[model samples]
Target: MKVLIIEDEKPAAKRLERLLLSYDDSIEVVAKLDSVKSVIDWFQTGKMLDLVFMDIQLADGLSFEVFDHVSITAPIIFTTAYDEYALKAFKVNSVAYLLKPVDDEDLSDAFAKLNTLKQAPETVNVTAVNSMDQIAAAMQMLTRQYKNRFVVKTGEHIRSIAVDEILFFFSREKATFCTLDQGKNYLLDYTLQQLIDMLDPTKFFQINRRFIISLRSVKDIISYSNSRLKIVLDHFSEQDVIVSRERVNEFKAWLDQ
Candidate 1:
């Protein structure tokens, strides 16, 4: 099988290539690219590849840019350090992926699965426009106008809290408070729904109608009854933050990613 590796880090790219060779002596690595531009350039030359191992974040920007420039017939197994939401989201649109520091067993399993699917009568087809739209939607969902700071009024004084300092947001008796890492809460002018539209999806996940917890703030996640999940935050003390049953799978995928 001919494969291409697109990872920005030299060490990572080299290690992945070595692993690919180790997995199967007959497998050939066609190329190792570090940036979207280089990969796009390579694809434009009309060289064919059986599969591609791509990294989400590249040297220039998000690797999603490559889909905008090239039409790749080969299936891509994306690699990411974080951003599980995109992984799950893309999988629905026919993308395979592995997390960073690629594991030998996982890599082998991914190849095995691909090989198995290759034997099926039907083939997966992600045309240029389809791939572009899927990737664009995922990117748009994850990264759109996230607030870096919020202005809160305390008594007669007003202060700004950086989004990084926030642990979570909670609603109680018709009031919304922004809890910080230092265990302080400030009332905000917006609602949880509004916060959902404002915060970065990678940084904050809206567990339910009541709360949106930051990744840095999560202390633990416990499986609950009825296929639900209970989230514990570092300094959150307001209520039991639970992931609704309908959202359990997505919540787990986000947490694990």
Candidate 2:
């Protein structure tokens, strides 16, 4: 099978190429392109491709913009560091959504699903129509407001904390707590996952399963063991904050943005 890899990170693109080749020696990676502009230009060539492995957020813009300029009939397996784009990804020719640092098992499962779809060509048209509908819905969802503040009760006193004033949110013993700049901790009734969807992504990032840190909260970033990163936050020393290895790349990208 001839495949196209659209990823901004060269190391990641190379790693994915190696994984694809190792999975099936017969598979040939025809091209590797980064950025939305390059991908749109490549697709305009009218080259034949059996499959495509694409990244949602490219260097220039979102990969979804490519669909606006060209038509791609080949099945795509989206590889990304963020899960927020999962719903929008399926609105295209996406066959699977694999999180960054994709492993062999996930690749195998994606291919397995692709094979099944190949056997049932009758559903392709239906999928295409549904994909367009979902894209519209996903766009509408993006316009919704993100949480700007939180209300917390402290000993019969109610105080509203601006989201920006909170340094970070962490989960401990099955409860979520946000720490303020003045070193005050407030218990919140939302899970880490829920906070991720409600908080503005530009301001907050869920570095791991336990912590959702704001950009203003970052004090220092140090390299950690196993390609992970240790984050230092102000007034919070209850536990060490580490960025998961899989999320390191995305974390850096978020910081740069």
lDDT of each: 0.81, 0.84
Clash pairs for candidate 1: none
Clashes of each: 0, 0
RMSD of each: 3.5, 10.1
Per-candidate TM-scores read 0.78, 0.57
Q: Candidate 1 — which residues are off by over 4 angstroms?
A: 121-130, 141-145, 181-184, 201-203, 214-243, 247-257
Writing each residue's lDDT as its tens digit, candidate 2 over 89-206 gives: 3545557778889999999999998888778888754235225555456534545588999999899899999998989999999999999989899999899999998987778899
Per-residue lDDT of 208 in model 2: 96
Q: Write the per-residue lDDT of candidate 1 for residues 63-137, one digit (tens) a residue.
A: 788878878878778877855554555665554678788989979888876776677626644322137667888
- For model 2, the run of ten residues with the poorest summed lDDT: 124-133
Model 1: weakest 10-residue lDDT segment is: 121-130
